[model samples]
Each structure stands twice: as structure tokens, then as C-alpha cells.
Target: MVLRDPLRGLARRRARWLAVTAVGLAGFVVFVVAVAVYRLTAADPVFDRGDISGLIVVFAVSLGFAGLGGLRLRVLARRIRDTASENGFGGWLPAPSAADDDRRIDFGAETGRLRRTTRRAAALVLVWVALFTGGLAGMSLLDEAAGELLATGDRVPGVVLSVYDPGKGTPSMRVRFGSRTAKIVRDSGHHYHVGEAVTVVVDPADPEHVRTTEEQNENQFVFGLCLVALLLGLAGAPVAAGAALGWRRRARAVGVTGWRVATVDVVPDRSIGGRKRPPPTIHVRYRDGTGIVLRAVLSTHGAKALADFTDRLAWVGGWGREMAVLFPQGPRRPGPYAVPAAAKTPRAASAFRRSRR
Candidate 1:
């Protein structure tokens, strides 16, 4: 299966699919390992008998599995390389050998515009749902962790030495912790008289910092949960938002049959993280028969591959969709990024292909 200029879009689509699959598989592996570790160790002390030897055995087993997986991957790659000239990944995608010649190719009538749109839209929706759900759960966990860390992780013991009334309904107490004494107002619900013992967690490094614990046993995983949840929530929020915006755009967009590249711009990296990333964004300008201009921010490889840009079908939208609702700056603002657009397009006759049985 060789992909020529007409099929470069397929390459881009497959690349994205492969990247996402790799990430999903890696995440599943990590989650399974984490669950197994928690199940195995949550019931026992960190340094129980035979724990060190057990961990060593587990490490060895894991290493062996990884080696085997790597070997299998290599074998698969070798097979792909050898048989690539005859078949393309068992007829799914175009092999490198197919693109070596200058022969014009067609994917058939079944792989039509409507089918492509449906497939891309469904994938985008699934991604959006997963990201939004994960982010929401992470935020809730983060809040709970913060509360637990405040209440239990920093407490010290204190004794109420004296109680006094200042003419108000609320009473005050002088609490003593070690050699330090501090005046504190009693909470309206707390029935504290004089000479009462209370557990107050205080920062050892900071004497002024104090907190009282109401919950018993305390949550030991608060700090770890907080860090993990914070990271997940922060990372997933933007991805979820972007996916949702893309989903909405596709839902409300007026489909343009084909788009031609008007220009390509390689701009300087201006983003915060761009200081270390030397690769600038590849911004491609596209226009349809209506003279309406749309743009796509692509990777350098995608841009380079689409430089010919003839007969390429792309999906783009203007100010009419939910872009105004999602973006505070409004949809009238000019920006470079078109949804559902790809680097490849089909000729008018080949746009519709026969269904593969």
C-alpha cells in the first residue's frame, strides 16, 4: 500500500490513531500495575517480612514480560518491512513500497466524505467524554485531599488552661502546647470549659500555624492524592475543553467539499513552553469556492506533506458556530485552526469509493 500525494491525509490519520493507541495502552498498563501494587501492599506494612524479596521477584517478572513484548514488537516490525511490497499492513493502510512509484491510486467508493466525517466525529466525541470525566473526578479528589491535609497532616496536642467570657455569646480559651501558650476563641459548637485536652496539629517549622482535627484516624493518602489529582485535573481540563470545542465546531459546521492551500507560514515560537521548543508552528492558509478563508495549524511534517494541496478535502467553519460561546474573545477574532481538515484530498471522481466487502 503506497500513499502518494493524493493519500497523504491517510498517513496523517493513521499517525494520530497510532499515537492515541500507544498512549491508551501505556495508560492501561500503568493503571493495572498501580492497582496490583495497591492490592498487594495496602494490607501490609511497607517493610513486612519477605517484602523486599517479593518486590525483587516482581521486578524480575515485569522485566521479563517487557523483554518479551519488545521482541514481539520487533518481529511484527520485521514482518511489516518484508511483506510491505505485497500488502499494506494486511490491506488497512498504504505501505512505503506503494508510494515509491508514480502511479495514481484510488481508495474506492465506500471511503466517501460522509463516512470519513462520521468516523472522525465519533472519535472526537469519545475523546472529549473521557477527558471531561477524568478531569471532573480529579478536581473532586483534589478538593478532598486539600481538606484532609489541612485537618490531620499538621496537628499537635494542646490543653485549655483557662476560659473567659468577654461579654459576647462566644467564649475564649487560653490553650497551652508544650511551653507555648496562645489565646484562642472557642468554636460555638465546641463545648470547651477549662482544663480540657484537644489535639491540634501545628507546623513544627512554624509555631503560629495551627489546625484542629475533627475526623478520627486521619486520611494518610491526602498528600499523595492531592499531587496526583492536581496534576490530572490541570492537564485534562485544557484537553477536555479543546476536544469539546472541536466537537461543537463539527456539529454546527457547514461542510465544504474541498480546500486548497493558499499559503504556508512558519512563525516564531511565542508560547510559554516555546522557549525550549525550537520548532515553530506550521500555519497553512486554505480557501474554498466561496472565497471564505480558513486556516489550520499543523505540524511541520503535515504541512510539508500537503504543500502540493490540490484536490484536498478539508472541513472548516466561520463565526456561526459555538466558537463564540466557547471563546471569550468571540468567533469574529481571526485565528489559525480549522477542524476536521487533513493534508490529503480526493479527486472529484474518487471522492466516493466502492464499499469494501
Candidate 2:
């Protein structure tokens, strides 16, 4: 079937989103400039509670619009699932000829490309693991160093002589321990008043080094960091393993050739975080000579580009888990591209079609 301006609606949608995004960003910039001017011209430079609240409200609204517009733009780029139906084309293409049935396309290049992509993804995951693990190790080393310092140091009663704030970091204070006066930076979140009586751990070898008992007891921050690192590792390990396994599978299926005639259906995109949505996926369902029904989900941009073929029977080629839908006379006359796919049951596939309607 031929289409005249099939993407007219999509083009209009994109233009509208572009305008909205521009307006939102412009509004945010204006708000920022206005706030800056207000602060500069006001008698009191500091913002009051009410002024802060008003600024927050404007910031949130402008940010929300900009975010919504950006998300809509992405959704438009990803959405092709309902293009045919929306454009008033709901019929299948003609059946393939006997020659088309016998034809097979080499998928060696596609398979290699998929393998490389998977390897890169695995490498990225490994990097993520290293970064988080390194952070955890660094924090652990710091904790150990602190523990060692407290272990060998002498505990002595001290009086805070004076406190000085550098305005950027933790406040430093002068404490008198017997005849020695040591200046020590206070632990984060700890407050010390001048002339306050406190117990201090003093390093015998270096009288200038000292820490409060409270500083040694505040291991909670370190523990929290370790916990966060552990959780991040747990989250990333499976993704890395999956990518590695996927690469291995593609490597084995490098030259494998499998073809089948499949009926296509566009799977609707679902909302994420109420406003954002992932790209739509295409579902191809077919039966082999053995009478078992199989479904493959194609999520690649190339596959989505073939949305005009929805509800039509088309040739599908597979190389292990990766598959490509053949478009003999596509708009760009592009070659078939290997798309990441997963298997599903026929019953579930039909349910998806029904739901899309």
C-alpha cells in the first residue's frame, strides 16, 4: 500500500512540542533574570521565606513545562506503532511470492554489529561497578585510618579556647590539652562553642593532632555510603552479566540463518513516571512448520521505521536472539537491520493486538 504524507500528524505534533519547549525554556530564563534583578536592586539582598517560596513555585512550573515538552519530543521520535492505523491504513500487504519465500539474506554483518553493541554495554556496566566499588573502598580506608588514630591516641580532658569558621568547610577550633594547644577541624554536623569543656583524643607523637570522642563515634555516614555502594552493585551486576551473555549468544549465532513469514503488529508505548514513555515496540507473530506459534518483539529504530507494514505479512530473519524484519520496497530502500527481540507466546501476542485497538 502507498501512503501520501503518512507522517503529517507526527510532523505537526513535533512542531507543537518544539514551540512549547522553546516557550518553557524562555520563561525559565526570564524568571532567573527577574530574580537576579530583584536581589540586586532590593534594599536587603537576602531572599525572605515568602520570596523563596514564590521563586520555587515559578521555577517548578517552568521546569515542568520544559521537561514535559522534551519528553513529548522524545516520545514522538520513538512512536511509530500506531502510525498506519492513525493514518487510515488498516489492511495487510499482499502475500509474498514463491521466490520471496525461498530468498534468504545474509545476517553476518548485523550479528557482528549486535555483538559489538553488547560488548560496549557490558564495558559500561563494568565501569559503573568499578566507580561505586572504588568509592566504597575509599570510604572504608578513611574509616580505618580514623580508627587507627583513635586507637593509639591518648584521651585527655580539653577546653575549647576559640572557634573559627573558614566559611567553606568544617569549622576549626583551638583546644587546650594540658600545656599543648591544638587546632582541630570539627567533624561535619558537629557544633562546638568556645570555652566548652570536652574530652579529646590527642596523638602522643604529634601533640598538634587531636579529635573529639563524638567524631570517632560518627560512623553512620560511612556506613550509609557503604550501603549505597552495595545496593548500586547489586543493581548493576545483573545488567552486566546479561550483556556479556547476550554477546556470547550472538557470537555463537554469527552465521546462522533462519527465516519465517510473520504477521506484524505495533505494540503501544506505555507511560513511564506518568509523563515519560519509552519507544514503541513491534510484535511479529508466526508459526513454524512444527505448528508451534512464536512471537518476536522488535524494538530497534529500523524496525519501528517499518510501522507502515503493520498487520501485514512480512519476511523475518533471525540470528539467535536478534531478528530483522525484511522490507523489500521500504521508503529509503534500506537493508534489513538486526533488532533486539524477545520471544513471547501467541496468546499473549493476540492480547497485545486487542489492547492496542
Candidate 3:
């Protein structure tokens, strides 16, 4: 039916978002690990060159991980639904009882819990990254300050490899200190030109440290790290909040039992609102004795979700099993065993006998 297509589309969209989030979290973790390894091992210049290839590898890994994660979630959803059916819940699954909340149904409370958990987990990972990056930046500044206090570095004659204006008004210089190159911003009254010989100071013990002005050369690196941390924190904050909000909404709906169930009698190809376009028209009849009728025109995605529920109803309806219907303005409705073929079944005959008893 038209319902399966829409449900499958929704599943695909969910998978896509899940994959993107997985990739982002994985990428950030990898970055932190790479930086730690580089600093701890004091890797050589070849390791620095390898950073470019490392980035390519990270992208490839992220894509691979995303694909695997998406497929896993889809499979999990299918498994949950199948398990619910086998448990004699029929084609429709309900939310777990409050006392027995460990049980889960794919389209109901279970899915909500999964989303909330995933969002919380992702948010926590990002918070950890932000803390780590901020700490690293702080440590870098503190170490530089200590180095200056100890006067450990000596001033040496170095050549300016290049002078580039980074559009910050003040020019920055890439100076060659012995065999190493360091980019240092020119202080007030200090001017530099390409290939010009300049006096640069270096730490004899750690040649990587070079000081020229009071404005810390390493501040730029710390600033960049802090900026990344801030961005990650910002992205994570809203996602966590939204997920929490969704959880609360779902909880309210589940607790209140406000929605009534209905079965789709027919899905019209044309819009019910007299529009020329197809407007997701569904003609459904209330399953309860009230004999209420409904014609719903919903969004594409909403239509898909409703169609899926109706498809389930059709399967059980064929067997004369009563299905639940969710109504727009009334109490939940129970379906009638309107199909005569269901009455001929041995199970139905036995059920009829039991009802009389």
C-alpha cells in the first residue's frame, strides 16, 4: 500500500540523521586523540606531513562508521517490531506498562527512549571534547608563561622565510629558527620582509619554543582550540535540549491516552480540500460504536506514519482481529470484527464460545 513507502521514507530519513551525528562525534574524538598522540610522542616532521593523510583517513572512517551505524539502527527497529508481534501483541504494539517499562515497542515509547538516549550520549561526548580542548589550551598558555619566567630560551639569529599579511592589519612572519619554522606576529615597531635575516629567540632544550614579543606567539593556537570547543558545546547544547523536550512530549502523550484509533477505509489519490494537488487524503472510520467518521489531510511525513498504522490494521483486520484506532477529537476506538471470513476460523469460534460462557 502507499503506507509502506512513506514509513520506509521516514526510516531512511532517521537513519541519515543518525549517521550524520555519528560521523560528527567520531570525527571530534579522532581529532582529540591525534593531537594527544602527536604531543605525547613528540613525533617528527614526517608525522606532521602525515597529518594531511590522517585527515583523509578520518573522513573515510567517518563515512564508513556512519553507514554501519545507520544500518544497525534500522535493523534494530525491525527486530523490535517483529519481537513485539511474536509476543502476541498482534499487529499493534502499545507502550510498556509503567511498572514493566523494560519492554519496548519500535514505533512508540521505545523509539522515543532511543532518540533521547542517543542525543544525551552525543551531547556528553561533545561536552567531554570541549573540556579537553579548553584544558589543552589553558595548559599551553601556562607552559609558555612558565618558560618565559625561567628565561630558558636564548635569542638566536634566524632568517625570515616569508612575511604574510593575514588581513589583520599587523603582518605575521614565518621565521626559520635553525631547522624549525615558527609563525610569529610582528610586535609594535617590528617590521619584517621575506628572506630577511631576523634575530629570533629559541629555547635550547625545546627548540619548538621561540619568544619575540610579550604577545604570546602560541596564543593563536590556544584561541583556535577554544573556538572549536565553543562551537562543539553550542551544537551539543541544543540537540540535548530538544531531545529532552521530545521525551517529555512523548511521555505526556503516552500517559494521557488522549488519541483515539481509527482504520483507513480508503486513501484517495486527490486532495479532500478541493485542491488540484494531492494533499495526503485519508478516509478512515472510527472503530468504536460511536460511528464517528474522519477525513484527514496531513503533511507528507504525517500521512506516511498514519498509512503505516493503517497497513497494520489491514493485516489484523483480515483475520477478524479487532484493531485500535486513534481519533482526532474523541476517545480511543476499538475496531469491529467486520470481516465474516474471520468468524469461520477455529480460534474465532473458540473465542465466541468463551465469550458466551
Candidate 4:
């Protein structure tokens, strides 16, 4: 199975991935807000070039972590399947909680369900990204439009009729702006004639330009929210992509491939992981009696991770057990591992047992 299944299964799971995703998203929002607020209150740059990668990395890590939970489930399923057939259970693995009962699970079904869940999660994530991008684009457009209109003054030649009531002491005027017009009434007792055609100055540099000195409801908050969304998305996108790549690398190291390949460890492989790195080894084992051996340079971390992961698989257990010989240090086969007919005896017998009548 691939990442899609596991990601989809994450959504279906009662695990912590959903909480992690939510927390990551919230953190993104908070970061964006903090930056915005800082810019609003201070004279510093809202964003720095050095911080872009960091922001992206954060989002990617968040996504990777969320996806990893599902991947772990898949790994667990694979392990269970491995233990079942390789460790004596006849093609059936016992459930974790149902170990007491005679209950067993079909690996294929478990794998399929996990796959579907992962696919669903991936789909949901894509949807979120699309929505976020779309929202950012829309906000950017609006911000640009507001700036442009303010720059153009947005004023067309028009007249206004002012009305004043002396008894109740009320004043109002019809104001015109660009192609549209509106009536501005003031609470202050400023009165004028009904046929007053006054010079209305709509400031070109200000979107809030109005001829009347009436109070206007400014929407700085709307811009702030949109800006927050934009920043969060901008920062999160690259990070998510990076995390995806990292995840793929990790998956590759775990013996997941279209063409099955095993590592044949002739020498003792010094398993290396975080902290002090260990030398990597290559182990290739085949189901047939025929087995080939080769030495692998474990310099790269990915390669080492793969070796370690493959080592944990039950299928490669027996091969790893028989490391009485060491593979040569070259591209050539490590040894002339000529399997005797007796070595094929058990495999043949097992195949025959499973063969259809």
C-alpha cells in the first residue's frame, strides 16, 4: 500500500493525528497573528527572507507528524501480518486486544482499510490547502483593489443637496463618490441650504475619503484576519511539501517498493539511528532457496534507516539469522552461496501445502 491509504485512515482513526494537525494549524495562525501585531505596533519588517524556510518547515513537520501516525498504524499492521505467517500463526494474526480470544485478523483487509483512511486524510488536506490558497488570492486582490482605488481618488464630478432642520436641529447632505453616491447625515447641528452644491474633495490617497465629516466604520479587523490567513498559508505550504518528501524518504527506507528487494546481511550490521550514526549495511533475502549477498555503504542516513527498517521485518528474519558468512566489499556477489537441495526442502513443502488442489 502507499501513503494515500494510511493518510486516509488517519482521519478514520481515534488517534492523536487530528489533534496534532489542529494544533499545528493553530500555531500557524498564532504565528501569523503575532507577526501582524508586531508589525502593527513596531517598525520592524513584517517578514524576513531567512524566516520563510523556517515557516515552511514548521508546516511541513506538522503535516509529516500528522501523517506519520497513520503510517505507524500501517507499519503495525504489517508487523502483525509478518508475525502471523513467519512466527507460526497460519496466515492469521491475533488482534492486539483480542489476544485472549481466538480472534484473528486478515492482513489484506487491515491493509486495505488503512489505505482508504490515508487516502481520505490526503484528500482532506488537499481541500484545506486549496481553500486556503483561494482565500489568500481573494484577499490579495481586495487589498490591491483598495490601494488602487485610494490612489485614484475615486472622485467623479457630482453635486449634493444639504437639508437642515432648525426646530429639531438636524443636518444632512447627499454626497457623491466616483460612480456611486450616498446620503451622509450628521448628528451634529451643522445646517445648510437644500440646494447647496458644495465642492466635495475625495482624497485620492485615502480609501476613506469622504466630503462630509461623518463618522465612518473602518474595517481594519477584516484586513487583519485575511492577512493572518495569507501569512499562515504562505508559511505552511512549503513546510507541508518538505514534510511530504521527508515522509517518502522514510517510507522508502522501510522496504516498501513495487519490486521486492531484500538485504542479505553476511556481516553483522551495526544498526545506527539518531544520536551517533551507525554504519549502514545491505541485506537481501529471497523466498526461493537461491540467495544473493552484497555489501552496502551505510553513509547516507536514508540508507541506514532502510536497512534498520528491513531488519525488523519478519520475512527477512531467517536470512539475517544465517550471517555465518560475510559479503565481499565490492559490487560482485559476496559469496558463492550455492544453496543445497536440502535448503529448498522446507520452502517447497510449504508451497505445496498452500497450492490449490
Candidate 5:
């Protein structure tokens, strides 16, 4: 049976993700252009049913693609175990060199950083929830009140008798509705001159109740604000959740005791664009008690610190998608210095057990 190379698989996955991300971004640009053209060219720019439905579909599909691409990118950032290499014992014959015994690590500083990250993430989630809920409630109340007024009122043509500035508030206008004159606040951006004929909605049960066609449509501004709030909440929820999960995993890994000896290999960065790239990912491979070779990806900062030591090995610790490396001397780094495989094995346990000896 032919065995698959884990490194080769990772390369292929990265390429596929890059293509997917490009397509998603292209779709978003198209959606934006379509909206701008539609609004600018139309005489009455209000979105009809068909227009709204089509826009929603396009936006949702584009968002889904972008979200999927991001998820795949995250997966590629973590460390993965290479099981195929275990079958061939020859591949694990020579162990990597270890770090100097005098290496220093600042565990306290790292822990503090993680704590701050967790708190920030929690606070962001709460803020978004509050904004989304308040906006939705306010919009609902406004719509209900407007609906009631429209249902109980009658439409009639009224002549504007006079227009005056209220001094303390918006401009006001007096309109005669079938011999009964009532004062109303003029809607913003709408001008009313004396003797101008306008359509008014009035309730016979309450003679004082009067509203112009323009007034009824004024609620559009409030609706727009609510829609913005909802969109922000939707977009921020995923980002906050992802940050929380990542930090939590790092905290757990840092809490683990003991360290293991592992060889570090730098993965070639395949990121697009000519712009400067961030730190490259390092692959850490080690053999557990079962003699299986397990691999994990080191964090960006950790990769930078260990760049010169690619020819040698280093001291690694932690379990699952969270691991850290110790150098002879480098900047103080946080937990989750690296991410390992999810599969539970004697790999991490045995490595730590040996550290005690």
C-alpha cells in the first residue's frame, strides 16, 4: 500500500484555500458593483421585492464562501500528526538535538497575556449582543406604531395653509383637511410652501391625528440604522468566538507540566502577494512511547525565535492544538506557542513522563 505524505497533503490544501479565497473576494466586489449601479441608474431607487431577494441571495452566498475560506486557513495554521512515517521505523532513527539547558522562559508574562485576551474577547461579544438586541427592539416598536396609524386613518388631499419654523424643533406646517386645520412637523429634507397641495392621512376618531405621505416614509432612516446594527452583530460574532476558542486552547496547553524533545522544520510560506509576510510556520516532529512520529506547528513568534535553530532540535511542551517551545534565550512569548494534533495518544503524555526522568 502506498503511504501519503502529510507535508505534501498540507501543501495541496493550502493551494486550494488560496483559490477559494480569491473567488470569494471576487464575488463580494461584484455584489458591491451591482448594488451601486442599480441604485444610481434607477429613477425611484427603492428596492422592490425581486431586487431585495436577489441582493440577499448574492450577499449570503458570498459571505458563506469567504467564511469557508477563513475556516480552512485556520486549520492549515495548526500542527498535524504524521502517522504514515511511524510504519517505517527507519524514518525515526535519528533524534533531533536538544536546546541548551540554560534556556529561560517567562511563564508568568505569557499567562497574563492570555488572561487579557480572554477578557477582551468576552467583552466584545457582550457589546455586540447589546447593540443587536436594542436595535431590533426599537425597529419593531416603530413599525408597529406606524402600522396602527395607517390602518385606522383615512387618506385625503390637504392644502398647506402656512409654514413656520418651530424655533425649538423641526419646521412646522399647518394643513387644512376638509375645513379642519391641523399643525404637523414637516419631515426633514421635504420643503412645504404655503398653498402647496399634499396627501395627508387623518383619523376621524382623533381629529388631531394628521400625517403626510412624506412623514410615513421618514421611518426609513431608523430602519437603516437597525439594519446596520444587525449586520455588525452578525459579522463580529464569528471573529469574537474564534478568538475566545483560540485563547482558551492556548491557556490549557500552557497549564500542562513538563517538556518534550522535538525536531523543528520550517514550512515554506506560500502566501500570495508581493507584500512582506509574517513569521513562517515551523513543523515540530517527535516520537512518543509508541514510537510513532507526531508533528505540530509552532506559533508565529515562536517560529521567529527558533529560525536559526532549524538545524537543531528544541524543547517543546503542551497537549493537543496548543504547544510551546523553549529557546536558549528569546522574547517572552504566550501560551499556544504551537498547535498539535487532536488525537489523544501516549505522545504528549509519554513525552512529559520522560521529562520527569
Candidate 6:
């Protein structure tokens, strides 16, 4: 299907977006695999568990799904626009395919926009990296604190050791670190010598490094969580960048019909009324400058597909309904990107169609 000019050509641009998404997916895969390997090999109980594997799997799936979904969208948008072109007169937009073949869509601005997301994502990843570093550093600090407590060997004056509550409870000095406090308990038969200072025998090299210490090994998971967060954050950078760029391009090409902005908000099932299959969704709402609101329910495919194809619609006047064809196999070109604003004034016949449809 072919439209007059601009409307017929959006499919080509969508192809470009698919390419960008592909690169992002590849990057994400590499990142996840790298992290998984690191953890699997570390032989750290914290890293080698099934939970870590689950996280890795989730991360990989998100990347793969996003990439494949993007590819599909581009394809569908291309198809929709191409087919719509041959059908009939489009409202505000000129058939984009009618544009000169050599005039590529202005992707430079789009590319820059996408890069901004990378910067933001990269900064977040950097923060995670810092957190991971801090965790390692903290282990050493913990060892120092424990060692200090242990140093007053046997008995030190004015010192008290804490122990689990007994039938006739022994007094325990509270060990507080910031907000978290742990009550040290006498390991069975051990009792504090009178006036003996209670010290934790912690290795100086590692705060977590302890010998004859009474702390649980469960704490190592904290470092593991930090490590996972770091990996996920870093892995997401490229995908974020690609998505941002794609949106920026759409905004520049086709401003939404009667709406200034759009967003794809995903919430947990519990948050949205326990939706079993992506519920209370597939909706489009429009608000006039005043308080009037216009909305309609959309198909699930419509919801996902529309998010990326904002640029490829022919707007109806007054009512401002934009025609977007929904499809599961995307990369469907819904249209030549919304007609350029400069060329958007509808002809008499299109105006008539707008009034009627």
C-alpha cells in the first residue's frame, strides 16, 4: 500500500528504530551473561544460589522481550502506514511515502535524544557501582569494629558482654551500628569475667572477617543484592537510550492528536486491581486545554503498539482522532508520520471525512 508522499514512507524510519533496538538487546544480553558468569564462578554462596539465577533470567528475558517487541512494532507500523496509504485520503498528514526517497528522516536529533537516556542510565549504574564498592569497604570496617571489641581479651575493666536472655538473664551491652543493632548472646557456657570488656574478635582486614565471632553468614547477601542491582542498572542503559531516542523522534515527527504527552506505565498486578492479563488498560485519554476529557478503550496490542508509533498517524480534525492500526506482528508502519505541522491543514474532502468519522 502506498500513500501520496510522506505518509507512504514511515516504514523506512521504523526499520532504523529496529536496528537501534537490536543493538541495545545485544548489549543487554552480553551484560547479563557477563554478570551471571562472574557470580557463578565467584563460588560465593551469596552469588551461586538459585535466586541469583532467577534474577539473571529475568534480566535476560526483559532485554530479549523488549528487543523483539521493538522489532515487531517497527514492522507493523511499516505495514499499517503502507496499507493505509493505498486505502484512501488521510486526514492531516500527506502520505509520507510520497516524500523524496533520498530525504531520510531527521534522525540526528533522535539519536542525540536517545543518547541522553544513556547518560542518565549510566549515572545510575555508576551509583550502583559505588554501592558495590562501599559494600566491600564496609566488610573491612565491620572486621575492624569486631576486632576492636575482641582486643580487650579475657576481661577488660568496665566492659560487659551481652548474651541471649536466660531464665536468670545476664546483662548485655547493646552493640549499635547506625540503625541496626544486634544483641550478642553468650554462646552456651561462656560468661563474662567480672569487669571484663566485651570485644568482638573481628579480622582487621575484613570487617566481616571474623574468627570465633558470633555473627551469622546470612549478611553476605547484602553485597550480592548490591551486585545484582549494579548489573541490572548498567545493563539497562542501552535499552533506555534506544527507547528515549525513539520517543523523541516520534514527538518531533508527529505530535499527538489533542494530547501533549504520552507515557507507558506498567504497574504490578496487585497495584492495578489484580489484573490477570494486562488489565484496566488499552486506554487512550485526551484532555482539552480546558477540563473536558475524551477517552476510549483500546485493545492490548493497540496500547503497546501506539506507544512507539505516535509519529505515524493521520489526525482527524476537531474530534482529533488519530488512526492507528493495531497488530501483534508489528514493525507495522501505521502511516507516513503524522503530517508535518506546516502541511497539516486538511483539504475540504478530508475535513468532511473528519466530520463524518
Best by TM-score: 2
Q: Put down candidate 5 lDDT per residue, 1-357, tens digits, no spaces.
A: 112233446646756885787577668756864565444333246987997898899888887887898788667645323222242212222232343132454555655555566677778878776776666566566655555667777889999999987667557788887878877766445787889998888767875666776664324457668768856764665556555655655555444333555555543344577442435444444543222222333332335444334534554544333444544344454333433322222233233233223
Q: 1-357 in candidate 2: lDDT tens per residue?
A: 111435556756877986887687767867864664454233235877997899899899888888999899768744522453343321111122343353344444545655676777678678767755664565556555556668888899999899888877546788887887877756545688988998889768876556776564324456557657755764665556555644544443332333455566544444565542333455555442111122234232334554434675555543213334544444355655544443332223243344355
The models' CA-based lDDT, in order, is: 0.39, 0.55, 0.43, 0.38, 0.54, 0.38
lDDT of 2 at 109: 53
- In model 6, state the lDDT of residue 285: 17
Alpha-carbon TM-score of each model against the true structure: 0.31, 0.43, 0.36, 0.30, 0.41, 0.31
The model with the greater TM-score, 1 or 5, is 5
TM-score of 3: 0.36
Best by lDDT: 2
lDDT of 3 by residue, 1-357 (tens): 011111334345555766575676567556755665455323122455677788778767776776776577657445434443354332222223342221222235433443454456456656755665575566555444635733656777778788777665546778887777898765434566677776676767776767663324555555556556645654655455444433333333233332234334423344346543432333333232111222232211123333323322321111111122322221133422111011111122122223223
CA shift at 219, candidate 5, in angstroms?
Answer: 7.4
The reply for model 2, stretches above 4 Å from the true place, is: 1-106, 152-156, 159-197, 202-210, 217-231, 250-266, 270-279, 285-337, 347-356
Scanning candidate 5 in windows of ten residues, the lowest lDDT window is: 87-96
Give the better candidate number (3 or 6) by lDDT.
Answer: 3
lDDT of 1 by residue, 1-357 (tens): 122332234434534544554454455445544544353223222645686676666555555555555455445433433443233221212212322222221222212332354455456546644554454454445445435556556666888889777785445667787888866645434677677887765655655645455322222354345445435544544444444434433333222111222333333344586352333322332332111222232322123223333333322221211111011111234322233332223211222121101
Ranking by lDDT: 2, 5, 3, 1, 4, 6
Worst 10 residues of 6 by lDDT: 285-294
Q: After superposition, how far is residue 356 of candidate 1 from its true place, in Å?
A: 10
Instruction: Tell me which of candidates 4 and 6 scores higher on TM-score.
Output: 6
Write candidate 6's Cα lDDT for 1-357 as tens digits. Answer: 212433434545555666666665666656655665454333232654887787777677767766776877657664544454454433333333322122333333333433353355456545655654554455444444445655643321223334345566443334433233344434324554434443444444554433234432223445456446546554544444543343333342332222122111211123346543322221221121111111222322223323323222222111112322112123356322221112222222223223222
